[model samples]
Target chain A: MTKTRLTRRALLAGTAAAATAATLKAPAIAQNAPIKIGVITDRVANSAMWATLMGEGVELATKQVNDAGGVLGRRIELAWEDDQDRPDVSATRARKLIGDGVVMILSLSSSTAAQQAQTATLEGKVPHMSPSHSADTLTTRLNNPYFFQMGPLASFQIRTLMAYAGTRFRRVALLTDNSALGTVNATSFRQGLQQGNIQIVADETFERGVTDVTPALQRVRAANPEGIFHAGILGAEMALFFRTYHQMGLRQPVLGSFNLSIPTYLDLVPGLLEGVQFIDVYDDVKPEVVDFANRYKAVHNKDPFSLPAYGYDGIMLTVDALRRAGAPDREKLRDAMHATRNYTAVIGARGTTIGFAPDRRIGFPENGCVVRTIANNKHGHAVWRGLAAS
Target chain B: MTDLLELAVSILEAGGIYALMALAYLVVLRPTGIINFAVGEWATLASFFSVATLGWWNLPYIPGAVLALAGVAAIGALTEQATVRPMIERGAPILTPILILLGMVVVYREAAALGFGTQNLRVPPPLGFGRIDLGPIAIPMQSAVVIAVSGIMLAGTWAFFERTIWGKAFQAVAIDRVAAGLMGINLRLVAAFSFAGGAAIAGTAGVLQAPLTSAHYLMGLPLAIKGFSALVIGGVGRVEGCILGGLVLAACERLVMRYAPIPSGFAIGVPLLLMILFLLVRPTGLIGARGRT
Candidate 1:
């Protein structure tokens, strides 16, 4: 009877030990450390509408990765910071994000602010991605392996516009506001036109906030260019220009930058903006674009602007790099980012096979622009594709 | 030469409006010894109200003009009574009254922004759109009307001050408020009258300029700067000097743009350069006293 009792006690002890081993192994399999991605944007917490859309993108991307069994059995976590459209503020935010163990950072907007964050990211050896800023200097002159841009650079868009203008118009005139962005676009456009064997009849600049553009437009009219291209955001100046241009009896075709099709421009000018053409990276009518837009609308109850799409794609690209790297190591991630060959994004098809060739750190697909023309003053229709060379 | 002539006409039209705004500033400055920084705000507010009256309410232009002018004048008088009169009663210094006007400027600008969104509105010109040709030079008909109205108002103002009893009372109050009060002139009434008149003139300028350049909350700042610059250049507190200064500044800017080797965008810099030159050479301005009081 004593022997049987001792055997029963040994069997009970074995069962207890087995249960403890299984519990410990379950945690190892179920609870992988989350990969932390730092998303620094100017949209969230600053503007209500932008905050919601951009926030949803980060949230959606994180959820998608987690739902798909995550990267290497580890779920993704996004830590966001608002730059508030200031460079100094963004730099401080980027440092804080780096200190918090974020492997990569995503900039919300503004080329100037992104450059500021990029400097900090390079110092910290953390990768930074910008969704909307297209400044060539960010990608070319300050080519840091840690930095990648998801949108087409300003030079690319300007070259495409100049190519089209060379074929259609004999002489092109440039009218730009006296802003940093405007000046860069104007200079790039001039260089592109020259390269394309097109002549510039006139180039004029106006004060940043000038409401009355009649005087400037009158001077441009005296030059009698085949077409006029205005490089500025659409607001009061755009409305004033259209009204004054119509009043002055100038029927020359007007081309504008991507800002021409923004909601503010449509709301302000209404019927006056008909027949205007602009260059954009994404068109809402395209199947891929429409699907994303509808999903964005369904989720956020508002149509997504081009900025949010770039932002979403930027986050996804970072995830792609992480997957390729197999870990969150800085050097490996940078290599994976640079080696991206052909990766499709919500904005358009981003070639993963093509990426930052050590010399070019910015990740932008060539021929990313699609030409859109205003049809009924309310909506813009895409008319051309693949203007920039691949 | 033809281009120069065309520019001159343009300058005259712009100058006429500036001169009117300057005169409005002088009307308040001469009587109250206070520079109403809110003068342009008053004009901006009146222009917006005029648009609301005509466009939103579907009233005729004449009624809208009258209502806007009268309403702005009343606001001016009330503001003086509520804000300025108490300070004057407390025997505050001259700068204190000026500061009050500066505060009013901020309040008025914010109020306008709150009342009307930041979007620019199109205000149709009061006169029909057409150009009147003066031989080789053609000018907008609106320009002629602005000049004519300014001349009539200036002449009427001169007559009132020089010939009428109430105008004499106003001048007496302006020259010496204590003495005017001792002589049984109602000091408060005269002060209110000056503010109302100044505001009305500003309202007229607003009504005139709105049709050419649409109304916006921020439009007042540049206009105020130009009007004040004219006031300083023409000799502070002098109506005729203000008019002359406005015309000279506008003409010089236009002429510089037409003939200067620099681009037209740099035209504003010319007036600023002239202002600096004038300050260095003739501190008293073209018509002001040579030395400090």
Candidate 2:
């Protein structure tokens, strides 16, 4: 009887060992199947160094996921297309990526183009994430289940800026361009100013390509506002504005939008750009910012712009959802992405929840805006943090 | 009043640049019936060459300017031979040749952008730091140089067109190309000369304007449009009309800014308004031929 009982115990132990082996080997077998993802961006190989950095960010994120055992036990493969920074081109690229079997699309750095991609993604039932476009319409008017924004939209930045300006100045002047993006930001700023009970002394606009703003500055100077909020892209006009404003001796504090942070603006205006303030979502020098910048610089021989961080975060988010879903099914991935909550990203707010409600199409943590001043031609310490009251 | 004076000075400066561009248009139009849409691209290419010569190679400014002008003149002559000759030989429609010029413009702009990245480039002013004080108003030495260059070029062009035998030959071709061809004029040589002179003037404008506004791919488009407007206002195929029209349009734009509460883009509309008034009063343009229209 004792011999029979010992034999039975040995059989039971063998069965348990087999079960453990199957459990471990099953995941390894499943992981052998590669998971393919398509990324569409404006980073044409022939574009500026910034576009190359964006491509590197996507590649790095994909490699990291593959290195750490990819989503749903499958290695992630990234397929990319260049949108060339055009809306129609991006839209077409999105459609082609979706047709080519991509689960999601990543966009280049403009709101107009993102909107086009979002429309294409929604129709194709694929998720679209924009890394650089800051237009509020992407989250508001065009919000959909397949669309997500990883960066603060323009309305958020403008509202935050207006609230901050209200604390210091009573009267303000605004100079904007005639572009749609400029109009939206200016309108949001005007609303924010009204909410803050700040007086708008002068409101003016110029054409996008105007080489000089002397006449516009003269009008604003006549209003004698204490500060000027310039809402325009970094182009010939900004250089003209600085030269004209300096020549005219308009000493009022000048603040610009994100366009001011562009490296081109720094190169063009140089010392004249000092004291200008602008909003930025991420700064590379910040310790909290991710390791992607270092990796990007190592690979591309240049510092990554704010776009790459968001691109890295976007791909990581998609991978995390796929991992959590534990399947290559599109429906499961979509559900898993929507269910994302308190997800941490390298560029996003730390210790913050990232999820989407059924009514809300975009992930939230959208409330961080850092006001940076150009000190000695470098972005100085943050003047304010967190979301300012609208 | 002081503001008005400042506006006037700005207008004059802008007008001077437009005048140089208009002279380029007049140079080609007077010799050949074809209006080269590639004028802006030629100027942009010349400017990039100037930037390369002066900024990259560390060449002296005067030699760099001359080299840029000479290089662009060669390019202009080559364009006439390679592109214009083919169209003319094929007996293509007038618009076909014009469209070809437009395509050349795109190619040249893209080529420049590819070669020099899309970033704005700064070119050091030829004139040293100095400003002319007109009482309370101060104008930079660069502006004075631009005005002086425009005057010199305009005078030189007038002498070349009106005083020299070659100038009469050019005028004779403009009056009757077939008749001048029958009279043993080398039509191809005249076309080559026109391209060279037009390109040199454009190169000069590019170098002078680079200091005030940085050089870039898209810089020439707006300037070209303004030049066309000046040409239309002055009357097409008229040199004196182009100069007068450019100055008048610039003055009107500045005056509108000084007095009217107009949007900055709408300031360009002032010239259109003047063009309309000129069309009504003098249908041939401000200095165009009587009863030609």
Candidate 3:
């Protein structure tokens, strides 16, 4: 209302003041903006079945974080890309996700694809992790400081099972499928058996899509092994093996890999897998798992399985780092994540935690995996814990 | 002797599936001259449909399975109607249709993946999940039914070609398309019929296998490879060749791997080796195409 001087100096000064004010407000608005995290999953491939549940866990945790006032006053936003279970595709997708400003990545695809995506993650200096129950090559094949794997390795399951088998049975046969991971598990199981001085009577592998496994089963029975160590990952192959075993009236106790922990096998051949035992990273009565199952059911209207719990653990680990990071920054979060210790996770045994004590890249605790027995034809409860199973 | 008998029974069950798939390829290849690698996807889609209708919707098993099969046949007709007819009208090369059919493989697989997700779905065995203990000849009840079904389909397809007027029209077109057209046979109609008929046979194979393998989208490619191998081993000429080739291929796969003192991986190579031998020695297969140019 009070007009003073119409000088050019006065007008320039006012414009500069306005510009400075906006500059000051920018970081505050950005601080309140959602921080996007990248998620690479195999949506339209064979791994999609596992990836879907893991993705749901990530989404649930994201929603819960946002609802509880976000991390460091900034909400978490997940950018999703389906890798199609291809290694090259996952690498390209990782670069694309990084370009889109994701501070971190959670790979929920196949382990091989996740391993390849580490190429981009290492180059981009983006913190990446696979919260899936997976193979160990992601940590062993690369020395990427930014990538972390939070699951028991394929070798860990074998050692644990061997420890459980102990002197109880001196002769054991190993049966596996012909898939790549199946071969890796077979090598691990064989090494575990040989190191324990257990007699390997028969080592057999059936083809992936082969409908009949009677020939392989007959060979195992002929060897007269006291027990059978099953390294089959595919549902159909495992079902065929069980059916043939029952048909032959072989009474050897069967020990299986963590892959059998998947609930899909419950419906494959009912009444065939009643007393089978397998290795897993879950104890049904653990407080953290119990809480997670209750919370998941409260929202999803069904029970949460092992896959979802691993996913929830992955995101929570990321969120914890972000909280201590004090900013939505890739570098700061990476440093903060590297410094994490003794995180109370929803996976593993009752007192098992998520901490990278000796091995930095492999975040799962040494004693995290447990051997569970199938009771009443389901992955019922954990009966043994630790690396040696004793 | 028991091992040999069990191995033979095993061969029959696996061979039945491969035979059905080979017949599907032959049925389409006869009139259209297109190998239709998508036949495996057709089988895969039919299995997915049956599992959804029967498992998820809890529909009565027989009606659900038949309806799913009919649905796949309709898709086959629509596929030919949409793609092949136009391409033929434009006089695309024979290799062009083959390439187009390959693209349809992706389309069908992605469709099932989208509709069903990535989960392995089960198709309740129409014969139920049990075994038939015929003395020392104990076999799964589903496998016995599958073998019977395969036999009936093969017999019916053989009779149709040997006796029916439509079947003769198909043979005439396969031998001489232009002459068949000159004699008042509809070439387009035969093409559509072959695709629909091929889909029905392949879909039956898929339904039969769903109980064994648990139907999945990734299942199509492996089966397509095996089916093509069976056709290569058997011959493209006579319908019975499909069964003979299928059984032979199955025997080579199971027997050699089970009894042979070599690496198990070599067993997979044995069939491929036989296929190469057949292609080089006698390209017409075990039964040569009579009027095939």
The lDDT per prediction is 0.71, 0.72, 0.84
- Candidate 2's residue-wise lDDT over A1-390, tens digit each? 999999999999999999898887776736365776877654322223345445667887887787787766677878777776677887898889888777767775456767877788888888777655566678777656777776666666766676566578889998777655677677777776777788888887776445456677778888899899887763666677776776676799998776666666666656777888887666444554647667777777876656567667778888888777777766777787877877766653333445677666566455666677888877775676546532
Q: Which candidate has the top score in TM-score?
A: 3
Error of 1 at A167 (Å): 3.0
Q: List TM-score per model, in order.
A: 0.71, 0.86, 0.93
Give lDDT tens digits, candidate 1, residues A76-109. 7888787765779889999999999888888764
**DockQ values of all predictions:** 0.10, 0.20, 0.57
lDDT of 2 by residue, B1-293 (tens): 76766676677777877777877887887767777777887777888888888878868988988898899899888878888878877888777767788899888887887887666776666874356778988775777788888888888887887799898788888888888899989999999889888888877777777765667776777667767667777877666877887898777776666557665556756656776787788766777632221
Worst 10 residues of 2 chain A by lDDT: A42-51
The total number of steric clashes, by the backbone 3 Å criterion, in model 1 comes to 9
User: What tens-digit string does per-residue lDDT give for candidate 3 at A1-390?
Assistant: 234555666788989999898788665425566899999998888578788888888888888888887788778889999999899999999999999999999999788889899999999999999996457677878899889888877777877787676678899988888766677778788887888899889888877677778777777777899999988777677777887787767899999987788888777777788889898887888898899999899999988878888888888999999988988889999888877888888888777777765456787876778899887877877888876544
TM-score of chain B of each: 0.91, 0.93, 0.97
Q: What's the residue-level lDDT of A390 in candidate 2?
A: 23
Question: Which ten contiguous residues of candidate 2 chain B have the minimum total lDDT?
Answer: B284-293
- Score residue B192 of candidate 1 by CA lDDT: 92
The reply for model 3, stretches above 4 Å from the true place, is A1-31, A388-390, B263-266
Ranking by lDDT: 3, 2, 1
